[model samples]
Target: MSGVEFNRRLESIPVYPAAESYGEDEGLIKLASNETPWGPPPAVIGAIQGQLETLNRYPDPAKSVLRRRIAERSDVPISKVVVGNGSCEILLAAGDALLEPGAEIVYAWPSFSMYPHLAAQSGARAVEVPLANGVHDLEAMAREVNAATRLVLVCNPNNPTATAVGIDEIDAFVASLPRHVAVILDEAYVEFNLLQDPGESIDLLSKHSNLVVLRTFSKVYGLCGLRAGYALGTEEFRLAVDRVRQP
Candidate 1:
């Protein structure tokens, strides 16, 4: 092998363990990836077919049409929306923009596997608070924050555990954080959560300028293969994430 040097930071990051795949004949319903039980509706399939003619052309780098649609749906200004290949990409972009070697990122232990990787890739310290009975101990997570903390990731209706904190709990948590700390409220499984109001978090954006809400089509919309996701935040935050995102 040619002697090539990789980023030393990558040395500490464990490879993300992807789920196992099965052949069509295996008759398996793979729930491990959190994919929908059914595929997208006919309308969605038709929309994809309509775009087949444009296969040779590149998609709009600005993602103008898609961003406008997401903005209209979320009832937020287009400037506040940043679309990515997936919600995971937005998470990485946030780390790239807000984290450095000395910064710290706080999140609960046994949460999304991606959390620890984010900290490692950014060369930021990972402050993992132990879960209180399989649920994110938000209080414990908040207590871990200090001057060096730059980002806090909260995965509501948390993966692997299906448990969620109420909106009031989230509101109070964000309110408690310092203005310098950016909170990434990952709502990947929000649609599956019947306990909390889905739209309540969108309202929190206007109240906290440092909060960035992430949503994805992969979960509820059955668009995991398409990799469409977006973030809702203040214009400043949107621009910062966009700057670091791939063109």
Candidate 2:
């Protein structure tokens, strides 16, 4: 195929996920959704406090400090990092940066709905392949990916269900993918993902230039309110994502 022939489902979607209710004035524990419960580390708090003096000034739009902190922790080089208001911003930025008018985004249906939503916003087609056996079916996913697929999402240790494939399984699946098609591992809750070794994605990036890994301080570092998150990959992919950060 010479790319997608149609794009209506994603391009014309009208609804966006919104708060079903704006309930009481902060009186709920909000366990309806999972949260870190523990906030940012004391050191992070100190750093944010130090920045309080410059609150009137614009925040470093590039977010160098937070990126550097994330790089230091993740062991990826600082230049390979890009920061945003929240992980969703980075995810949407990836969608905008990577997806063209007819590019197809392939992700699991009961996984993260945002993959398709962001694709719709960018006029890209959402190729939602169904889940299998309560976990990501690597073979099924690979079969669905065609030449038109620009991005493939692997939400390891998937949300709600919290099931994950083995590290080798993930690596093998990534190895089967096209080098030019972006493969994103949404490891947002990896801190709680007791299944596989945490270092797997970092390992994958060294070999696969197409690999993208997303992590957030809102979960393990416990700073969702502060809206800190990042997408990790080779510098090339990060640059591709950064190109769309402007309003």
Candidate 3:
């Protein structure tokens, strides 16, 4: 007898290791997640408290307020921004809009583990370009692109390793890719890198119509509980992702 069939990729995908809870007396320290040691600032707490009255109400369908604020901060038009639960949701939207069977999603390994899972769930092939000394091998990744490639994910200051590719390096990589393939610059950890040398990928978006920059309040802003994040890209690309984003 045959078992019920589902997407085959689901069987091989790695599960995210969730942090286990501990009793107050256990003295067990949870380190599996990257949660901040401190709580959000007083202003943020007060702002959240002010929204208590609206707890029963559904959030705005368009996420207009947050979208406008993100647009102002990123200096992009508001129409180009799509706010979501977190940047991960934006990545999922990218997968839904761009990936399918026989399609490809190229990214660097030793990076975000979610990239492969996202690609697989979308029924797309995941082409991992091995990192060069823990940083993204942009040149090699560019070489992996072909007509069937739909999306490329570049996690700047890449996860786990905390290494980043410079602006010039990425600018050249995006320029080398075909127009049909869209690129997502995962900048979730960008705030940490901005202190010494702020990257200019966002500034270069005007020239590269295929690039999308993702950011989140989960890290530096200490808003992981709120799950606020957004994407900055061309209006067309944002709309494409929005088509898959739940209203």
Per residue, candidate 1 scores C-alpha lDDT tens digits across 25-134 of 55665666877778898899999999999999999988999999999988999999999999999899899999999999999878898888888898899998988999
lDDT of each model, Cα atoms only?
Answer: 0.90, 0.80, 0.86
Best by TM-score: 1
Candidate 2 lDDT (Cα, whole model)? 0.80
Model 1: residues with Cα > 4 Å off, grouped in runs: 18-29
TM-score for candidate 1, please give it: 0.94
Report residue 62 deviation for candidate 1 (angstroms).
1.1
Off by over 4 Å in 3: 1-5, 21-25, 194-199
**Relative to the unseen true structure, what is the C-alpha lDDT of residue 62 in candidate 1, on a scale of 0 to 100?**
85
Q: Rank the candidates by TM-score, best first.
A: 1, 3, 2
The CA lDDT at 162 in model 3 is 85
Candidate rank order under lDDT: 1, 3, 2
Top candidate, metric lDDT: 1
Could you give the C-alpha RMSD of every candidate to the true structure, in order shown? 1.9, 5.4, 2.3
Q: In terms of TM-score, how similar is model 2 to the real structure?
A: 0.87
Per-residue C-alpha lDDT of model 3 across residues 1-247, encoded as one tens digit per residue: 4888877788879766554334455666765457788899899999989999999999898999989887887778998988998888888888998899899999999788788887778888889999998888898999999999999999987897888877888888899999999999998888887432443767878989999989899988888988988888999988888789788
